[model samples]
Target: MTVAEIFPWQQVLWQQIRQPENLKRHHALLLKGRKGIGKLGFAFGLTQSVLCGQVDAAGVACGKCQDCYWFEQGLHPNFRLLEPEALSAPGGAAGKENEEGRVEAAGTKSGKKPSQQITIAQIRSLDDFIYLSAHQARDKVVLIHPAEAMNTAAANALLKKLEEPPEGVLFILVAHGASLIPATVLSRCRQIAMPAPEHKLARDWLVRQGITDPDFRLAISGFSPLLALQHDEQQSAPHADFIQSLCVPEKFDPIGLAEKLHKQDLSSVTSWLQKWCYDLMSSRISGRVRYHLQQADSIKRQAALMNPVAVGFMWRNLAASQQLARHPLNSRLFLEELFLTYGELIRPVGSETR
Candidate 1:
């Protein structure tokens, strides 16, 4: 599918993609953004746009052409899509287990598990693919999703290719955080920053999808429409109620709240916390609040009582808690510490004296 078909917001980016003048000197392009924002989709569309033998005046691929048809069927020799094999999910066959175990063992020797890191074997295979002649199109396109999954060695190996890439080849690296990549990799490609959609735009998109809840909009303001939909379904009902309770300090229980959150997915939990903070900042600044506005009074009260630096420190702690959640840890204790720290940060300084 075309970029426009994948994401309506991509029209702006597609305009630039269509301009031949804009394409010069950037054979390797990095598209960096959070997950579920259609970065991979965009990269795929750009691949088709570049490789399509027939193109319309609007610069969109003619989907009916042989090249597009092959691409649609995953038979196109010119297009390569690579992702971590761990993403395939676990269980099923013994053979599958053996294969995965071997890959994982190889990965571990290289300092990371296969599920955690894309191995050097995977990166080396790209060289063979890129060196071969394209079957139909003028260029060969390689799209690497979550490129940060490459281990240090794998990343370095890929860097050598990026430094002196073959002619008529394009490398598209999709990353959630560009900071994870080496400076050499960062310097080799054109960087495209894809920020989250505007709140109103996200809300409108959600409404079109039949989700009209104000709470849902508040919970996912800065996320893409796809992620908002997922969160609306996956975020626990109790979690929703708990977030609402932030408005009423009497209902807040640091340990109990932490216990609840510890059961949820790390990415979703961190996303919710980030969006909540963004909403709090909006309430503090614009007085035009969306979700969790009932907590506005408490938020403002605490904001006034605490030093601004201390408040910033609390945010930093929240981010750290989220990051720490990524690795293996005692979820209960970790979350308890996080919420207790939050409670301490929000409590009035002189309440003990009273």
Candidate 2:
């Protein structure tokens, strides 16, 4: 069996932490970083290594071992993974949990939309895993991904466990927004600030994955390699359409665009608008475009004719929109309102000649 690969950028960190002594010192690890930087993959790699029946001198999992087999099959008696039910749903966040690549969660077999927030029931269900003796008397590992997704009740429930952690059990919490997690919970874990790769490094990694126009994807993904890959595979068309419409603000039909995008993830759609406005503000003030390098010319033109103060306000307003995007009462109405507001920010290309 081949050991799953960790991202190249993580090699240094992996080397430093893979030592058995390092892992033995911590009962819980909080792996925090920007979205799509592969925190989940790192956590899984660490878990596999720790549970492997045979580990190398470098403390890497021997995938050929029985424990590795169990892990790959998702039937490891000693391992449990906790994540929002939404993530397990079709077309949902997957490993893309935060701003860069959140997808709308689909409904479960019961036709109910899977929840985006981790519930208290999930935390409570861990009782057996946390209290019961580990299989074969080995260490038990419980991994909660995007720990911030836990609601207040869930968080409080987990806090009780963290406060008096049982021996031989390891809790690994992965979070994109660690600040959203409770301070009391954070204090109980060994926090690790996961690293994002440099531009060149991330670009190189994307290239190796056969991504074309890697830089554009990388920039739009907030420089996260995993999110960049996700954009290439899943989001390319909708994103391009959204940008093209924005490029021609005069021809932009908010209702039409909203109609087209309402079926998509509200959070993701809002994020695109947020990034576009960010570029607009950035262009107007500093003559720079951050996310939309391909649309620099259009952004520059639009920025020149817009009010920097108004754009600044609009950009800030979108932050609130992001929060609302999660559970909007009417997605179409929400988007229509969003685009209509953007339409007000930009005058037609030739409306005012310099």
| Candidate no. 2 TM-score | 0.89
Candidate 1 on 1-354: residue-level lDDT in tens?
A: 223144667678878766887665678899887765667677777888777888888777899898888887767888876666554323211112111012122333455444656678888988778887776537888877668878898889889988888888889898877799888888998999864666676677668878867345434433455555555445558556667656555456878877777777554555555555555555555664454555667666545555555556666666666566666377778767766766665567767611
Whole-model lDDT values for every prediction: 0.66, 0.86
Q: Where is model 1 more than 4 Å wrong at Cα?
A: 1-6, 21-25, 33-36, 73-75, 88-114, 195-200, 218-223, 259-262, 274-295, 327-329
Clash pairs (backbone) in predicted model 1: none
Number of the top candidate by TM-score? 2
Count residue pairs with overlapping backbones in model 2: 0
Candidate 1, residue 235: lDDT: 56
